[model samples]
Target: MCKDKIAVVLVTFNRLDKLKQAVEYYEQQTYPIQEVVIVDNHSTDGTIQYLKEWVNGKGNFKRKTVLLNENCGGAGGFGAGMDEVLDEVRRHELDADWVAVADDDAFPRKNSFEKIIDYYKSLSDKEQEDISVLCSRVVNCGKTHINHRNRIKQSILRARFMAVPEEEYDKDAFDIDIFSYVGTFIKVNALQKVGTTNRDLFIYGDDQEHSLRLRKVGRMQCVPSSVYDHDRPGLGERKIGWHSYYDSRNHVYILKKYFPIQCLIMRCIKRYILDMSVFSSNTQQERKLFKTAYMDGIKGNLGKNSVYKPGFEITDRKD
Candidate 1:
């Protein structure tokens, strides 16, 4: 028997088209979701209208939307969404035993949630007691694609730990130290203990930090039977553009919070070398932003985003 109903919280910004596709896919889940809570990070691209219309047109599942006033990035969006659902659960208004986190571009396989529930139900009570989060095998949306960004193999060196690669998808489920938010299944009990995602990190590495925080209370694993397709291409060495600031800054916070001193030092050296090596046409601007992120991170200054762009915040649902 399923002990608790599943609630999914998805965070979205300006990607209305992708978000629409994701919602349609989720609405068709074979196992059926109890509720879907969407956190819109102030989207100006008529996402609010789309969601309102979708909710009105669909009556099979409970849907809720939270409209933020500004662009809080993925970290803040997830934090806000999770806290809202947790509040409903605490108030006895929503009987959600497990909460799943997803990106707006993540489309799950029809049987994915079913597979997760089955694997979770197969675990012994003692085994279940030790597990906190269950991650899904995430792959690119096209044929013959391997997604290295979704999985990780823990190591002393930050480079090794952060970018652990799996060449292909596996059929078995196993424990893992790190994962992304593409399709992260977390237990309500664990949240009650470890708390929610960090809102301050704002964007990059927040998922990593949250996973580490969850580890302090329980274990995490990847359920290979469950899978999702992310509407993203395989990534290479990314240029330091607008994304570089958050990537550089939040990484520092993650290292400071979790890594040992020796590991931290080695990671710093390796990271510095890699950062310095990756330069393109906009090398000077990239270097300046990178240095700024590094210094801010070192100072532990996690203020509001100085570089974030907000989306439109509005309501179309009159009810």
Candidate 2:
């Protein structure tokens, strides 16, 4: 028997197709889920209306689509959705033993939930209780194969994108030292003890901050047996325009909030050196964008109204 009733909280902005596919994958999970909550980030593209219609047609799942009046970035949307879930769990109104946080663009494997549940059962009671945050191996969505070695190399590079090396990627359970919000399964009790995601982050680094806090309370693990296909397309080429701005500014916020002064100093130095090397090989436009992002990183300027943009809409339904 499944000891935990899972609540899958998905946050989406304008990705309607991806969201629908992700929900379809969720419906196929072997392990039972209590509910699926779709927190709409005020998308203007009729996403809310679509979800409303979809949820209306599906009566088997206790699905909820929350429409935020404003478009809070991913960080704020997730925190708010988590707050709602935790409140319901606390009141015993919702039978949620675990809160699974996933991106709308990702799809879990058919046996992903079963694998996670089995791993949970295998652990000692103490270990089970202590394991608050659990993550699954994420593979490229479009690609059918998993590149374990490349993932390991990416992790070692400490590149802006966090990825596990292909060789280190195992299809088994293991403890994780870092916290990843995307496609992570969190214990309800552990989340309550550690607190929710920081809304101040407003965009990036929020997961890392929350994970750091979770480590203090219980164990975090990467379950290789539980895998999900991340729907992000392969990086055929680099597009470093607005992305550079956010990436640079987010790192600064992370360092300021979590890292010690010396550590932050060393990080900045390393990043500067790396940025210079990267820019040396890139086009003029790419170099310019990277330079802008790097400067913004130093100034800690995340941009104006980065939390929400205009033309965004909110809805109460899944459509």
Candidate achieving the largest TM-score: 1
Clashes of each: 3, 22
User: Per-residue lDDT for 1-319 in model 1, tens only?
Assistant: 2384789999998899899899888888988788899999999999988877766666557888888998888889999989988999999988888899998988998999998888888888888778888878776755423332344444666433444346334546766676778888998888888888899988877888888888778888777678888888657775445567777788886777676656567766665665543532235445456666777777788846556323211123121
Give residue 139's lDDT in candidate 1 (0 to 100): 68
TM-scores, all candidates, are: 0.86, 0.79
lDDT of 1: 0.76
Residue 66 CA displacement from its true place in model 1, Å: 0.4
The runs of at least 3 residues in candidate 2 whose Cα sits more than 4 Å from the true structure, single-residue gaps closed, are: 141-163, 236-239, 270-319
Task: Give the per-residue lDDT digits (tens) of candidate 2, residues 238-266.
Answer: 44444455556667666655555565566
lDDT of each: 0.76, 0.70
- Cα-based lDDT at residue 167, candidate 2: 52
